[model samples]
Target: MAMMRNITIGQYIPGESVIHRLDPRTKIIATFLYIVLLFLVNTFSGYACSALLILLAVALSRLPIKYILRGIRPLAFIIILTLSLHFFMTEGHVIFQVGFLKVTQEGVVRGLMMVSRLVLLVVGTSILTLTTSPILLTDGIESLLKPLKGLGVPAHELAMMMTIALRFIPTLIEETEKIMKAQMARGADFESGNIFQRAKSLIPILIPLFINAFRRADDLAVAMEARGYRGGEGRTRFRVLRFTYKDVVALIFVAVFVVVVSIYF
Candidate 1:
């Protein structure tokens, strides 16, 4: 599907804007704080502030609005499912009624809140992945989780796995596209089926996809081992990460934003 190529949630775009220039650790921490605040928000005013923050970040990233927003498309089904549940199950003064089912004023408000929360959450995280490179993201995560290494946690290993997973998203999508084209060449009918039939048609695609994925994983492991790779013990990075003045400013902004949203918004 052409729509599959448009998915950019886990892909990084190369840019020189302030957002892309900031240290990955700063972006990661700020995103975590923003998500925390999003969960705390219960009012439209709070969501307004949140929207402003995400918009500001998007503007600074110097990325096309469409590219950033396209990441939300793949999530449309989940968003609709969540909104439907809240709209139907929440109870208040009935706004509309059909048979035994009622749409209430409270349901409408709650559904709106859930929609805003989900949108903000997805957009905020997408910004993180969009600006930061996979390598930097891994380093940032490993550094942050360095504290947990004291408790027998495999911090570096976990970070490596997470980084590989994120890095594989675009690769897997591209692979799927190739497989689809190959199947289409072989008279596979992926587009002419109903819901269940369409899903059934995907069996041919899925079989090769899973096989290719396993093959790639094995190849990656072999390559790593060939390079004398072992555990993360005493691993040295060529690019040493440091906190710059921009990182300090970003942290201050997050702190102020969190305080304002928590107490005032």
Candidate 2:
């Protein structure tokens, strides 16, 4: 479970950089816009521009390059699988053929494009999560969704749930690690076993995790009720969020990147 040990969500390194200081809502919106534009992109030049923009954002976030790459390590297998499938399945002029496997130029090009798109998308979104704290992100979401309240949506409740879930991801991962270690200490061999046997060994871990999760939920509910927690009725926020000049500048830069990619690529 060494791989699982390093999994993190809502993981942010404290920083005072420009990317870190922007409104969380700005980061969220920019991420969405960037993903949409990435798909609209269809040329190598466009991808290059997008990559450059992503690199610039990552640099501004001031997070270590190793940490960002580590966050993406889990996706390496999927990216390779996608590239392989595209490289073999698409039809075009055959570039290579061996042992009944045919590779085409178009397939190769398409595979590279798809892989690039996935990489850029992951890096772009990870930047937002890596720079902004989960609490702030959820607060931004709730504030943004306030308009939906008119449509009878339980926006505040939904946002609160999301925030709580995000906050607990790291905690749950640590708990899972401890459970795995404890089971291993009791001679529970997860490795060197058949798939079915290994899966059965996980039952001990899963049962406790589920039980504890439910217990925590119940306790939280009781605490909230004791505090007279009503659902979004006149709830006041502790920290009010406001977009700053940095947010405007960021938006402008994103817009320019989009336009340039669209026109030149």
lDDT of each: 0.90, 0.87
For model 2, give the 10-residue run with minimal summed lDDT. Answer: 4-13
C-alpha RMSD values across all candidates: 3.5, 2.6
lDDT of 2 at 82: 93
Candidate 1 segments whose C-alpha is farther than 4 A from its true place: 1-9, 165-222
lDDT of 2: 0.87
Write one digit per residue (lDDT tens) for candidate 1, span 179-235: 988999999998786899999999998999999999999999999999988979988
lDDT string, candidate 2, 49-147, tens digits: 899988999888888998778767889999999999998998889989987788999999999999999889888888888898888988888888989
Highest-lDDT candidate:
1
Q: Which pairs of residues clash in candidate 1, taking residues 3 or more apart in a chain or in different chains?
A: none
Models 1 onward score TM values of: 0.80, 0.87
Residue 90 in model 2: lDDT: 89
